[model samples]
Target: MDESDGEALAAREWRLIREERWPGPMNMALDEIAAETAAAGGPRTLRVYRWEPSTLSLGYRQDPDTVDWGYCAAEGITVTRRQTGGGGIYHDSHGDISYTIAAPADELPGDLVESYRRLCTPILDAFDRLDVPAAFAETGRPALHDPACYLRELHPAHDVVVPGDDGPRKVSGNAQHRRTDAVVQHGSLTYAVRPERHLAAFADPSVDAATFRERVTGIEDHADVTRTAAVSTVEEALAEWADAAEGSWTEDELARARERANEKYGSDAWTRRRPGDR
Candidate 1:
């Protein structure tokens, strides 16, 4: 690496947080907290986490009516809203591997696409490390307007896909939420696609498992690695990319995250409200 590259890598103390299981609301809350903390000069953080009880996270502007509330409730799936925009994602604890990267906005590329590429570098590396060839879609696809993220159109810059018999199928869906002081990008990596549960979360009746399977794919489908190994590989790739040191959440941070969870992410006012309502 060049002198400038070394200085850039050392600019912030990167903290690597391994997998932690939490309820849906708390996971979202923690991402917000991490961004705020980084803006306030805390360590830049890269974290891998899982959603307990399998939650359905709606996009910031996504209509709650798109969700099948009755089915979600009966199936014991938690519903929460993400700070970022995109379609809803059914994060199965066993099938989904989620991650987040938070840093001061000024430290990264100002252009949105450029920033996504910079942050997603590690993710692409992780897929390669697992012997699953993956890359960003070379061209954008027409939007399907499906309520589920994986079923939506692919973006050339951020949506990571793996080779398939038909074509490149999306294996990961990523989105960013930029604040005045910091940026947080969180994404879902499909370790194993659960078609039934994924389709059941949406209210649309016409979409079925076959439609979902055609568009979305999983890492396990192309690679022999187990979910646990895949998570570890991703964590390692992120840590190396950031040159991060092992870390854990502080007590005060957790307390603050819990408060935010209850007031925002976990509340019906936030989850059920229509876009532009607040």
Candidate 2:
């Protein structure tokens, strides 16, 4: 192909993949497909979704067995591994919203840390719209390896946090994967916490329920806005952040996710991280 033709093929698209409320496994699978597709040298896309019955997602290199699988299964709490690496997070069905962004590598400037700050602009904007004073952790402190996402605060760009009980606590969790062509980042936005489930699901089970809740505050806690309103606000903020680019998804993307899940996310081998790893 000619240089122009190659560049044309490489140009990314702006789209959104809105999947139905699904289990954790399916959700992770879909993200994999979307990331791969975006890396295939197409347009950038955003995916917004929710979980049914709630769930806990471990980081890709995390040990799935570290979580209370029995408790999760008994309560119908789905657990899955994410394509990005970090820590485990609890998805409250009515309390939090999930978002993933896939775009060409060249679309962003600087290294992974710089890209994280760039993507977080919209989230910071969303918090501003809600009148919440949110800021990114600039000091790159290493996050603790705990089941609770908020316990470990590290600055790898913008891990959203604000002053709250026990001082500043992370209100959102994010992870990123950059390939030769595309970078996909996904994260959890905390709105509510079922303390019991949160504590029980952890393999290391350390944080107290009250302390955990005290540390993490959602939109509802900060303002009069409900979770629904927060989600709507985030959507609008993200739309504006992308300069009015529309978000969308397709059937082909969903198929690709399932295939990737079967091969990567669903495997036990990919769920545990080695020492000194993220």
lDDT of 1 at 144: 59
What does candidate 2's lDDT look like per residue over 1-278, in tens digits? 23553354234356655435877777887766666666776557776789886878886566655788778778787777776666788887887788887777776755777778777767778889989877875454344445456666665474777765346766777778777777778877877656677777777676677777656767667788777778878878776566435655567776776777666655555544443454
Q: Quick one: best lDDT, which candidate? A: 1
Over 28-130, each residue of candidate 1 has an lDDT whose tens digit, in order, gives: 9999999988999999999999999899999999999999999999999999999999889999999999999999999988999988888898999899999
TM-score of each: 0.96, 0.84
lDDT against the true structure, per candidate, is 0.91, 0.70
Root-mean-square deviation of candidate 2: 5.2
The number of the candidate with the highest TM-score is 1
